[model samples]
Target: MAQNRDDDANDGSNGTSNRTSGIINSGRRGLMQGAGLGAALSLLGGVSGAGGLISTAQAAEAAFPQHKKWKIVFVNHVTTNPFFVPTQYGIQDACAMFGMDYQWTGSATSDAGEMVRAVNSAIAAKADAIAVPIVDPNAFDKPIQAALDAGIPVFAYNADAPRGKSNPRLAYIGQDLYLSGYQMGERIASLVDSGMVALFIATPGQLNIQPRLDGASDAIKKSGKKIDIQTVATGATVNEELSKIKSFYLGHQDLKGMFAVDAGSTQGVAQVMKESGLPSKGVHGGGFDLLPQTIQLIHEGFLDFTIDQQPYVQGFYTVMEAFVFLASGGLVGPANINTGLKFVTKDTVEPYLNTSTRYEGKTTKPQIVPMKGAIKS
Candidate 1:
């Protein structure tokens, strides 16, 4: 819901506000000296109060040029999913910094057609830029090209087209899905030497998560282990995912491990692992995202780990790319950005459990989170 706000009031603490204030104060002093408005505005072009000049490119790096407020439309596959809360916050924070606005629109379920329609709508409305998760390989290609044809930049976030596939989206800002999944599989192999494991997915074959499944399966196969992997398709909603996971566990009590790739499914695996007391039975469990419950379950030693895909940066960086492209009049090209993946185990999940901030979509209040010790990679 925070993403729905058309205009977010500045708290005057961000760099953008400070820079604008400094510019204004400098302008006032220049005006008092009869230097005129042009001389005052020249400060943005790297003119110092001491009369030193800097290159225009250097000035561009420090401050953006004056421009109209741009609007970005983010078309998502699951508009109301809890996993994307921090992602929307990222969009909001970046947009606020650049004085831009964004609209969060898409299907509540993982409906590629609905998401495609939303993309078309954004293009039709002449949005300054557009962002969307290319959940369907081909569904979004035409719409993205249409947006680009209209001189509007399009960026992909959360999900991307399959590798080596050409879609018109300028860049991708999200995790390296297959690599993350392969690494997860490696972790799974380390945990359970050889046994039955259940891998739950919210939606099967969706570009957003299918690659992870494929990668995990391939990794397990490549390991040449006796692990039996049963891939289950859990529904899109959290409750449905939980029920499906529970049902699968009920049917296969001999499962040695439980895991998932999506947020809701991962949380479901944690829940089922705890409810069934599977960890006590030597059942290893893990998945992805930073859902509060998943973090707690890991802290409690029920789930082995949850991969952190840094969802917030997915939205924030996508907006950053869009902003620079729009601000520079297409001179700055959009490039693929991997937000990154980190394993949040019990040993490393304390900060996640202790802190509640907009950065993690835990709370709406904005504040700098304090660092207490050495940062872990």
Candidate 2:
């Protein structure tokens, strides 16, 4: 499978490419020209060019030079999910770029308690920084505060605490899940005309996906259409999700649309839609994230579209924010970073399927692909 290539490509090995080596050498040369060998060597932590495209070593004379390899602990809600594979790669890339280490630990089953425990453990360890997806609104509030009190910088990624909630996490580095879902709901309203729509969510009431479900529901309802929205829960496992989706389709043969809020559930929706030939029957479907299967299925006309929340940046930016906060000694306070949401449909999935790189969680080999045509938004 394509994902197997992705997994093998990014097996956490520090294998350097010629391109990266060249970039590093260039950065080192620049440092040497500006300072003596000792100074340059000291500055040799990590360097980068515009857009962080060129991997460089760190500057030794950094503003916050403790000589200690700051470790960032990332507590995940679903650590093993393919949707987060690119995210983990992002964290890895950022850590390497910034001369830091990171640990990925959390519940593979999306258990909030397990995630909370991971956060608490990071605090107890007095980690340099902590990054987590605030999957549960209240469960993370106190633990996050504890981390803050312990002097460990905490940042939210992918999922965040709900708005107006006094969770004292410094900032959020992810897409606005609710607004994205609301826009998606508006998209669905444009496509489907007042029929039963089945929206599948892997887990409900979890902040990671609940807001999306709520937003989509609200938007569809606000459309003032007689669209019947029936939500079904697809279990954690991909197999279970697929089975549930198929079962739901079998029961609701007249479903006008099938949508999902998560990656596994989204793929399940596509599989069932393809198997049932729902698109031919004028049934619409789409959801968030770009699972390889989800992209391929969209290309094949089985699925209509998928939203790209840029999962890679969720991790990348979280680490970046944490580094800035730690480096600036709280002078650079954290801010909510919306990673952005984009719609990928048949017309735009070509690049995704054709390219393989860490940016999309596809490959570890870091070579820039040259673009030929004018870009369209």
Candidate 3:
């Protein structure tokens, strides 16, 4: 599959908007009609499992069987990320526990074209359910439509399509990216003084992380601090990210804060900030997800905060939802599932240190810390 490599840095573009465009074949246009108005919904009853997100499926009246064997496809953005290790574990574990067959595949990066192909391949294999990270609003319209049209239940997990984009991806099973951004910005506000802030992202306008960048931008702007915001893109490589952060800082040494919207760039941002001898103020830093490195940076006092979108829940629930909906008669919309959000900081990172979080590294079972009240919101 061809890839679209765009610099996601907010240097020229504020990344406050999703500016991606691609043509959805006319035949598939109608599939993009499903959207929401934040209507009055009350599915609070009969909710079971983590975060009250299991289900109230039409099969709510019928007792759910303990064993179900269905095939599910999980299309992720960064398939190799350790942040996804637990997510994958969650999906695989849930599939085993629920008696479902699951396959995990996605591009190494947030390439919408690659993800669309993965979804199509899953459909071609006649998957019973599909879970995707709707990273590109324009790019995913057709494939998402195709899945739904094939009588397959598709759910958007982790990153969602831009709000009101008319993508037909059944329901969203991930964090409220923008709200997490707002919370990240709030934490940054507490750490940085009045000055310029650098917003680092992997690929702007891709799908999942852009909403978070936009959210954080809005919140930081709302803070009434004389903060000049600059967006910088880190091409999808760890060394590239480290170099980019170093370059941005070398060029603009006065930047007061650095906000990274992805995990890889978060660590880079912190490393560069530390090497530049910038305090948490002169270059206050915050980011998304908790990789071991990002957490280590936070402990070493290089990063002010990083949002935890509960990636494990994303992995666990995406499978659970797909499994339940496949067995049930209909879809599991807001009427059923909800992916949660949590912005983690120094005050909150301790509890997570020992919790069964989604940041399981290779060859390491997630360690649990039997404590609470460390990270701030």
Candidate 4:
């Protein structure tokens, strides 16, 4: 008796056709069954003994097929900022790995209203998923809900809505902005002694940098030191930020230190300190991000330290969450992620200076570089 296809399906095995079936009456099939070792080897293209070709049905089931190519849209507050160069690379790498697509669009000047419009457009276009910075506390609330209502998943990255104010975005993937600033403030306290310290920011009330400014101010107040901290507003443009920093240095020659809460301002602080020879003047300075100039200045002792918030992973995990949600059909929920913050100073700036990779927003080519020494804490 010949076993049928239905019988093979119910057998709980590999679904190989049983030769005992009378339906396999062809002479070629009979010859393959008869010549045990040599014929089986030839049929299998190398294997010996009873091992031969699997049934067509079994082979089809064994193949691992590709998943649907889902598209994710990312809305940013600062669309052209260099700080997010690595973040874009992260999104690109993750999308390529998962066979997905992504779009980067947002306001160039951190306009909350513009970001809201982008969210609405994404919803209208029926995007698979969306990621946003949530830089405004109340601005994103309605738009995120609208996205959710449209059956599209949404996530937050780089920045998040304020605490105690509920925004409907799923998760955030960036540093604890306030905490990072508080810690930097403590460091500033140790370096400056009862003199004026200038804290520069590109945007004063913008959620992305405001919380950090608040944290730094709070930490300085908590220290109970006679430190006079002043917040200076640097314009959004890098050249404007640099000019402002230079002018500030010129006027506040007696200042004890300068620090910044944002990327462009941080680089400006480094440049001002270097040209003014502030370190030799016993004037300490530090700020956030690992801009190439910032790293070089830190190594040269022009600036004290700069924080690395792993911007690359912020984009990487945002896409990963979106992919999982689309693939698992909502069974896998997105979770908040904190991309780590690290202090890079003269002692630890070598690795950043030596490496030219996408992770650092340094280069476009992918590569693996050898480490020379044990990593420092």
Best by TM-score: 2
Model 1's TM-score against the true structure:
0.85
Provide TM-scores for the models: 0.85, 0.87, 0.77, 0.82
Q: Tens-digit lDDT track for model 4 on 127-174?
A: 899899878778898999999999999998888888777888888888
lDDT of 3 by residue, 230-260 (tens): 9888877677878888888889887788779
User: Residue by residue across 1-377, what tens digits does model 2's lDDT show?
Assistant: 01123446447622211111222221121222223346655544455456653333444233233434567888887766777777877877666555567788888788999989988988888889998988887888889989888888898888888877877888888889999999999999988888899999998888888899999999999999999999999878788899899998999898899999998899999988888888999999999889888999999999989999998888877877776666666876578999998999999999999988888877766566888699977
> What C-alpha lDDT do the candidate models reach, one value each?
0.79, 0.79, 0.66, 0.77
lDDT of 4 at 325: 70
In model 4, the clashing pairs are: 2-21, 2-22
Q: Kindly report the root-mean-square deviation of model 3 from the true structure over all alpha carbons.
A: 11.1
lDDT of 1 by residue, 261-356 (tens): 998999999998888899889999999998888999999999999999988889888877887777667877688998998999999999999987
- Cα deviation at 68, candidate 1, in Å, is 0.9
- For candidate 3, report its TM-score: 0.77
